[model samples]
Target chain A: MATGWKYRTAEAETAEAIDRRCEPRRPLGLRFALMRIRVETELCQGHGRCYMLAPDLFYADDDGYCHPTGERTVPAELADQARRALMNCPEDAIILTEET
Target chain B: MTDAKKYSLEPPEVARNPHDTYREIRDNAPVAELAGRSQTGAVTLSRHEDVMRAFQTPEVFSSDPGAIEIGNIRPLVPLQIDPPHHRKHRKALDPLFAPKQMSKHEPRVRELIRDLIDKVVDQGHCNFHDDIAEPLPSTIFLELLGLPVSRVDEFLALKDGIIRPPARSMEERQEKVKATGQKIYAALEEVVEARMAQREDDFLSTLIDAEVEGQPLSRDDVVDIGYLFFLAGLDTVSASLECMVAFLAQNPGHRQRLVDEPEVIPHAVEEMLRYESPVASAARITAIDTEVNGCPISAGTRIQVLIGSANTDERAWDGPDEVDFDRESKKHIAFGAGVHRCLGSHLARMELRVALEEWHARVPHYRLADGLELQFSQGIRQIDNLKLVW
Candidate 1:
């Protein structure tokens, strides 16, 4: 039982480490790199304007709420689109975060 | 006095001194059970803290059953659903209304506002609601949704039926609501189908292809979402705009302030929203028995969060009744709070900001026509017929 428990714990830790390493690469040296858009799951009311404005960057997952496209570097051309997506969120669910 | 006894959801006179009645309720009974023989039987939370708390916990306060019943038209979008589910829908649509996204349409919104204002600025006398307030937001909404401009009248008529039912009896009201809702639903269904077939770059197409939980949203889901956007988008903004204009007319000093310093318009819009909230009470059902303030509320009790009243609470704000454009720390419940806050808040703000800036730049001075009786509807409390002359 002890050996089996140890094996299970090791497997869980290995999986978590892999997830951490495989996480999408955030934009590097981006001006708004630290800007975090926090989405409040509860308040979204889903008017769909966010997806309508920036389809390439933001897509609604199957549940009908928006999620950012995998961490691709914010291209210079799409920065404005990102800003619009952040600001236009009707529920004010998106919050911009600046990393120190 | 407990909120349980002080206020009736139905005010004494629809138009007369609503603020005072609200104040009475807020001070006397923060959460008063409003006897409902008319619409859905529900209670009201008039105090700032109480209303704020209700919005904060949406699981207990669902925005479902449609804010005001309009027959079979169920709210299919994010607002009606509880958390987890609500989050997904909100995420899917947030980008469309972002401030930057709205900037692309700013020029058009300004043009529409200018055109509407131009029609009556010269007349020097016109019903603000009919000539300007009603048309401006409706036009903008149609344009944004990529709907046909010609359907504006039909949309407005249907909106009115749902918002302020004129049918003599509840049954009549329900029937009218059903008829109007059916028209809107059918129109939306057709628009969605056409957009899907054409595969255009509009909101409809985006919604058609949007995936949730790895699956695209259903066609019926798209219609329900569109219906919410159509119904809630225009009227709320128009009402708020009407209130802003009326307040400015009554206070020429503030009007002059905007004319002199247009930069203050954004802040001024915040003040107006706080002063006269367009969307009044949003409904929520308690998921569990909760204690708010000191009162114990049972699970499943319907609570109506009176946003307008909460915005004026002296506890949260200083000189709460006065519309001070420069008020620092102007956090308000006008757009609601937590996850269920208004999604189009930024767009609505932009529209109002531009409208005020342009109006003050052009018209400058205006007044209410003498002997004109101001009116108020059930859900919204503001001047129904504002006659302005510049």
Candidate 2:
């Protein structure tokens, strides 16, 4: 595990991200596709931002490269974090996909 | 913008202060040609978008042998290897430098910082560059590589010879670097042979036992890999520390923020890395004839991806010139981007964060020495005369 020093910003961002998520998400009836985070293994250069930002949704392997945390679908609470991870990845390896 | 402008990076003026020059080139000519240097036809991509494009499209922009000459007999492993093969080496090596792996060394790193700080804390002033910035990283890296820390001066000299050779002409520079390169190879060979005879608890021993693509790395392969790590581990963090400390010395408000709020050190490090960009530029070769933002480049043309410019490009960030520790999204590529991004970034970040934490705790207030002008090194922006007073 990386030291707690790295999480200071993540903790602060989590609150802001969650607050933004509370602006009434799209109606379930209109939401036809299910959203999930995907780790494109080939593209990942192990920058480690994804796992650092979204620890619950993502985890690192022995090589410190990212891997999905058992579940691919982004939990309602983790949506903001998933997006934050996606946005911060230098390699653009993280993908948020809609499953039809 | 249609014609590639010529800019010489060899000048001491640009070396001392590059942000203005970088901004000028970025604004006027995104793709500029090298005015003076050994790599004659080399061109630089100053725009953030183009730099990122080069990193992403490695097929078009390669890191193969012809990219740059650094006195290496063989291509430095992984750094010179592109895709497919690059992946194998990374898989075997990435785990060694991971954040978790690197964090284990934090305590010792902190201790080293305290020791270095203790020596100068009582004094009203100290040469931050010589007394602290230079020694800290080299000592730590020496331990990591299983090399004797006693010979750090010798090792650093060899690295400087290749990176910043003192010479009147390009021929002289290459000749000096080549001779230094021979010495470096001999040194690596001596240690590698020792490790082979009896394995030890070090990176070299691990690499010797570890496999790339299920085959053990050859003796030459280990030397090549060490060749890259030798240059990288010894210099990069030292340069980063100098740059960051120099920035803080000039900016008291920013310095106070770290002392007041220790938690912001991590973010501040990232922001400074983005702003300082000590590594400056990365070398690559045009693998195929490609056009960058309407400027057509021929195949095999040397490319200098100006990372310093990219981190500050307005198109990439809002208020790019502003240095904000609390900046919301720091996707800056101070560690470059794409597949060939810096492997030691995790370790580098840990070192920077811990060093800053300890320095502020000990010497909270410091400013550049009176009448002292900092002259940054040409390739890697290290300050040899970064004197500071509290």
Candidate 3:
């Protein structure tokens, strides 16, 4: 469950702006956390679970290995799906992070 | 150092229901010496964590030729090759079996399954194994390999000769597998030679032109890759179909659910694959000294990672024995883990899902023939006489 949010000073502002644009449904002032999705290609055995579960966020290469589809950063709307892919990957290869 | 406990995997009962023995081994001895197989210095790892560790650390737990004898003269391509080289071969092969590529076969697979069901539906009872399970995947596999579908029986016989050799002793088993291996090689050679002379739009011809590290694969490499696929593509899905259908026939409640809500068939297939892992154990050998839970294992020792055990280990699940389709996380190493995981998984999953969907739609109410005890063959777990009645 190490979300890898330690180095947040650099990308946090830009991530928040992207999240607001992608997820306008988010309440105006309460809080905004930018989510990121990544696949550790080395650990990924091309199980294809990430692409199988979260098609919008991931697509498989010719080798069946996963690559982020649109952007590495996730919108709030797709957070549940990103988590689903992370949880179901047998290799535990999917990395999900939240930037505050 | 803790002495390794002895566990026998040869008992008929164990083959019928291995989870109980797996549970005992995990609780009492996570790493137990495999007895009764007539193989020395062999051990079984039953714990999920240990199994995963062994798979991930293939540098220590190597899958070279010495791992287990399947009567191949050389290490099967991609499967026996360690990383770097293995990655290259897989890169050339994975795309051919990728989900998108496999999805193209969905229509054919469904049509085949429906055709098989058509022959059996009118009958009050049918030997689901012999009638549907065995033929479906083998036919598809033969077609994929560009081999003659008319020769499926011959190919299946050759496959069974190696997998379920009807021998009482290890020497006899090896001898039989070796002889059968020669026949398989000759058969593959004939096909590869023909394909080389006149290429076709199939897996064999594709592999002929495939490259690894900027060089086209040698003829031997193509044959070696075909050898692996010949065994893999024919058997695993068939065994899975047999296991799943047998389970459903016995469990009326679960079957009714599939009939009621077809969307759940995929999840149900995942659960059954975990519960009755058809390819129960995967073999490896130690390239260097290794230890399992503090027990020392020297180099060259044989290891059998019990995927069935890991799928049901209490340490890995809340109720390990229960089969729940609603599980939020259904991750299991039934197809195996690491780089050598089964390459045909997507094809197998699609076939299973479609077969179940069509079967439940046609014959929703069925059960195991009364007084029949399913005799699942060891290793692959195919129930040759899985009769069911509606």
Candidate 4:
């Protein structure tokens, strides 16, 4: 026969379990968000203008081909510039999106 | 042009039909001397065998004085360094650009390529240079260097000043180029300083911490290497892609082949590199007196290896002028050779493959806009404006 209820130590709970228990009560505004840029290769001619303009967000291949970096965490000041790079691509290869 | 006279090195014959000129040179004089302002004269190796031999033997032909003059700005690293020393610098950076290492970034590259294609797939009309080629690599370069994306305009202007100097006096061009170099140097310095303070996980930070022989690289070394990576990664690849697109627009059948058989992209890329080499010529100083194609060359003599001509040489390739994606024996000097071979070769191939694959997959039919004026600059072969309609 069970005496009553089981007592679990603080260390016994996993992050997922804590999240599941607190999810319903927590407010949505406190959650972290993410944003990303998408590139369409068919449109890209590898002009490398993006690389020239935004060395931080773009890189090129040995043949002067262009590709985006994985981490798209734009700084507050650089958001507008990143957007411009996306908008100005001669190939229209870049697409920007935000996710919650 | 008379057969006896040397070819003027200035104002590269971008507009002239390259094939006709190449044929004339090949028939009249396979090896001719090139006269330029800075260097008195250099032997021009036009035939494929000669060019291949010259590029392969770096000890004999050195890329020390640069393939072409870029006014006042110092020549970028690795590209300007001859063997031994060049190998050391290349060794330091090669691992970062290996095929397997670059493959890790493929998904991101594919994503960029796809998004770019989607934008103009519906429009059916777009200026490819402005819409695609120019921006894609520019953005990519910035991201790799860990610089501020906001400074792209500044970067473009500086790169243009160096790569495409305004049609002005030499002195004026030199002044502008020097200023541009200083700006780039300052920017790189600032990035290095900031990264050192924060010690973040980025390429810039890694470079800052990189040591050679138990000593960290000097500020100038960092700046020079950074400059090389920027220019090499940006301009050459961009120009090659532009040429590829232009060729596809002109040759519907070849373009259709790529569309129908995506598996042939890698081979197709090799063929394109052979057909339209962006780097037309590279200069090398004769380290020792050497004889090329039976002509004796003295030490210190500059030699211009015509890579574009080599790609089209009749002896090396069948129907070399034609864009045959199915060519069985396709070996090209597009990425150069030996110790000085491009460190980013794999990266360049991946980019080209992805660009061609995604482009053909989306826009199955496209044509160059009629009456579109094509402008070509010296030292680099790239279309200034490429208007397209699909």
Q: For all candidates, state DockQ relative to the true structure.
A: 0.04, 0.33, 0.29, 0.01
Between candidates 1 and 4, the one scoring higher on lDDT is 1
Report the lDDT tens digits of candidate 2 across residue range A1-100.
1223245322335534533443334436545556676767767877777766676556556676775432255656666777888888877777887666
lDDT of 4 by residue, B1-390 (tens): 224354443544533236656655666667777544432466677887787678667788877654455532655676788756775666567657755466777787788878888888899898887777776666666777787778877777777777877755656766776777787777778988888788765567767877765678776677778887766766877787888888889888888888987877776787788778777777787889888767777888877777878778887777887777655444566776545667676777778888888888888899999877666555567677789997
* Model 3 misplaced stretches (Cα beyond 4 Å): A1-30, A69-71, B1-6
lDDT of 1 at A8: 12
Per-model TM against the reference: 0.78, 0.91, 0.92, 0.74
Tens digits of per-residue lDDT for model 2 on B332-353?
8999888889999988999999
* iRMS, all models: 17.0, 6.1, 7.4, 22.8
Q: Residue B97 in model 3: shift from native, Å? A: 0.4
What is candidate 1's CA lDDT for residue A59? 51
Reference-based lDDT, each prediction: 0.70, 0.84, 0.83, 0.67
Candidate 2 CAPRI level? acceptable
How high a TM-score does candidate 4 get? 0.74
Q: State the lDDT of candidate 3 residue by residue for B1-390, as single tens digits.
A: 234445666687888888888898888878877667644667788899999999999999899989888889988998999986898898888999887788789999999999999999998799998889989999998999888899999999999998889998888999999999999999999999999999998999998988778999999999999889989988899999999998888888888989998877877888899999999989999999988898888999888898999999999887879887776666888999998999998889889999999999999999989999888887788898898999
TM-score of model 2 vs. true structure? 0.91
**Residue B390, model 2: Cα distance from true site in angstroms:** 1.0
